[model samples]
Target: MSSPDATPGASSAIGSALYQLATRAVRRLPRDLSLTSAATLATLDKTGPRRVTDLAAHEGVTQPAMTVLVRALEESGLVERRGDVSDKRVTLVCLTEDGASYVRARRQAGVEAFQRLIDQLTEDEVRALAAALPALRRLDTLDGQKREGTRP
Candidate 1:
């Protein structure tokens, strides 16, 4: 077996640890929201209103599936469809005030959940995670920049 300290093993170790943490964090999210709904809210919140096709692209779902999801969110009063200003033929999905509130609540819950998990970590582990934040965030930002084609 490759030693954990070996150069080739380092990235694998980090990736594995991050994957575990991510799965654990996701499990702690509020049970009420289905993954589809939560992700839809997050996408609209982040990118503002978008065409159904755009939302579907971002969520990696079929246009028909996104239509159904958006309809559900609309019925729940979390979102509304409006005519795109630039092109009246285009409809855009926009988050309602209730939707934004739901997003905030979900985000807060996730933070609290992560904190709870962190509480179980050793002090040294906590410090290590804290120290790693900068590099992690930098990498994340770079990734977003590449996708967005602009620095954030």
Candidate 2:
């Protein structure tokens, strides 16, 4: 089985190989979208509208930086700023319809790109990847658990 916590210590060969593959695959994609922007869209999509301060904290950026990002996104028609219903004083950043579509399209493109790479692999290699899919999915949960201060 693959190790769960590569955040703190050295990763095994399996982890290294997986990381390399993922990095290579991502690097092969078009650079039209920034990772930060795509990730911000995904975060908003998952958690709903949030304050610029909250978003900055989530993204590990400064509030001013996030404001700049939000402004740029707004200008691009990817996201919009809105008054918080519960608190008029607080503004929230939300994904525009176009933003959601961009996130989905980018994600699909990534999957298709990776699938093309997979298609070139030998049958047994593909089977190995298939077998590892469950474990790979578990890493998402494990990372969440870690973020929540729980061991997985």
Candidate 3:
């Protein structure tokens, strides 16, 4: 029988490992942008133009906080404000061409760093990770669902 500490079902151990890995990965990112800014940029890139309120909700931030972030991004030419066609009073946030390129480059750098680390893993370990990728993606979907007040 395995010791309690050795149990594979230990949630705390899994959470700790996930946190450490995430922290290290973020540290490996380029110094050009803060993680929160990078995250906002990436989200805009992936989801196209969005309302400030919607973006704030998606990012789990208050509207005022997101407004501050959006202002900085706009000042840096990384985002632009456009009038919403259906609602002229509401402004939508979208990435400029330069913003898209910047986000792509930053993302590529992070991918390269991760790829280098993955190269050190054995073929079997790499395959194991590949197998787990789907489940990891599902976790993101599940989290989004939870945030949207939906049952996963």
Candidate 4:
């Protein structure tokens, strides 16, 4: 079969396939947190502390929903709410040390999982993926840009 990139009109197919693959990988992993929660933590790890409202907007969730989620995380001692230095009236959700550790551990687990799977692929397939890594990383940057409203 022709690679998705080699065929025209295959963008949608590739996108759907990638989405399915990612969701399946995540689902197969054991986790205590909900997907949204994990995503929020990951975002916080990438960026810094953010207002609850900002997090809601970034996560495509309602502010109230994010509030509840943040509360849960706080209860778990994974995150804490603090007054924003520049704006005392606004509260920022900051990841705790525990939260950072959790994020690192989760990411390591994912890397190990993917590494094991990649080991099963043929050498040519592995080479192909290695060659595509740059583009894949660029896609991640584009996603971040889109989220930040810097990309069209």
Name the lDDT value of residue 65 in candidate 3: 88
Instruction: Name model 2 segments beyond 4 Å from true.
Output: 1-11, 145-152
Against the true structure, candidate 3 has what lDDT? 0.87
Write candidate 3's Cα lDDT for 44-84 as tens digits: 99889998898888888899989999999999999999999
The per-model lDDT (C-alpha) reads 0.87, 0.83, 0.87, 0.91
- Tally clashes: model 3: 0
Error in Å for residue 101 of model 3:
1.3
Weakest lDDT window of 10 consecutive positions for candidate 3:
1-10
Worst 10 residues of 2 by lDDT: 1-10
lDDT of 4: 0.91
- Tell me each candidate's TM-score: 0.83, 0.82, 0.83, 0.90
lDDT-better candidate, 3 vs 4: 4
The residue pairs that clash in candidate 2, if any, are none
| 1-152: candidate 2 lDDT, tens digit per residue | 43476555445666788789879877876687677777788888877899998888777789998898899999999999999988999999999999999888877888988889899999999999999899789887886666435787
Tens-digit per-residue lDDT, 42-137, candidate 4: 999999999999999999999999999999999999999999889889999999999999999999988998899999999999999999899789
Can you give the lDDT of residue 150 in candidate 4? 90
Best by TM-score: 4
Q: What clash pairs does model 1 have?
A: none
Query: Candidate 2's C-alpha lDDT?
Result: 0.83
lDDT of 1 at 114: 83
- Displacement of residue 28 (Cα, Å) in model 4 is 1.7
